[model samples]
Target: MLKAIIMLILGLSVLAAGFITLKRELSIEAFSISSADEAKSEMKNIFNDQRWFYLSGIALFMQFVFQGFHLTFEYFFYAFLISSGIQSLFYLFNKKELDYKVCGVIIVSFLVIYL
Candidate 1:
C-alpha cells in the first residue's frame, strides 16, 4: 500500500512535469520549437498526434485494476514515468530533439531505477 502510494505520487509528478515541458513550447518562452509562432504547426502536431501516452496510461490503469495495484507493477511503472518525464525535459532543453543522448539517459536511468 505504501509503495503503491509512493509510485502514484512519483508517476503523477513526473507526468505533470512532462506536460509542463510540452506546454512551455506553446508559450513565448524564447525556446519555442514550433515552426512558426503565428502558425504553431509543431505544437499542434505534438498535442494532436501523441496517442501512445494515452494508450499506455489506460493500459497501466487497467493493469493496476486487474493486478490489484501490485507493488512490482507500480515500481516499474513509476520508474518508466520518471524516465519519460526526464526525457521530456531533456528534449525540451535540447530544442525538442529526441537524440541518442536522451535515449542513453533513459537507458541508464531505468537500469539504475530497476537495479
Candidate 2:
C-alpha cells in the first residue's frame, strides 16, 4: 500500500515536472509578434529549434515513467525502454555533447523496476 502511494505521488510529480518544463520553454507570452507572418515564422522557428525535439523526447520518456509507475512494471517495460531510447537519441541529436545524463537516472530506475 505504501509503495503504491509513493508510486502515485512520484508519477504525478514527474508529470508536473514535464508540464512545468513545457510551460517554461514554450510560453506563448514570450512570443509577442505584431504580424501574422512573423507569428508563423516564430512558430516555425520554435518548432525547428533542437530544443523542441529534446523536449519531446523528454516528455515521452517522463510520460512513460509516470504511466509505468501508475500501472504495472511488466506492462510498461518495453514502453519505458522505447521512450528512454528515444529520449537518449533526441538528447544526442540536440547536441554533439554527451549530455544524456538526465535520462541515465530514469533508465537505472526502470532497470530496478524491471528486476
Worst 10-residue lDDT window, candidate 1:
49-58
Mind giving the per-residue lDDT tens digits that candidate 1 earns over 1-115?
A: 5545544554565676667767875774565454467467655765773433543444344444445566575545644554454444454456445344345444444443444
Q: How do all models score by TM-score?
A: 0.34, 0.34
- Name model 1 segments beyond 4 Å from true: 1-72
CA displacement after TM-score superposition, residue 64 of candidate 1 (Å): 16
Global lDDT of each model?
0.51, 0.51
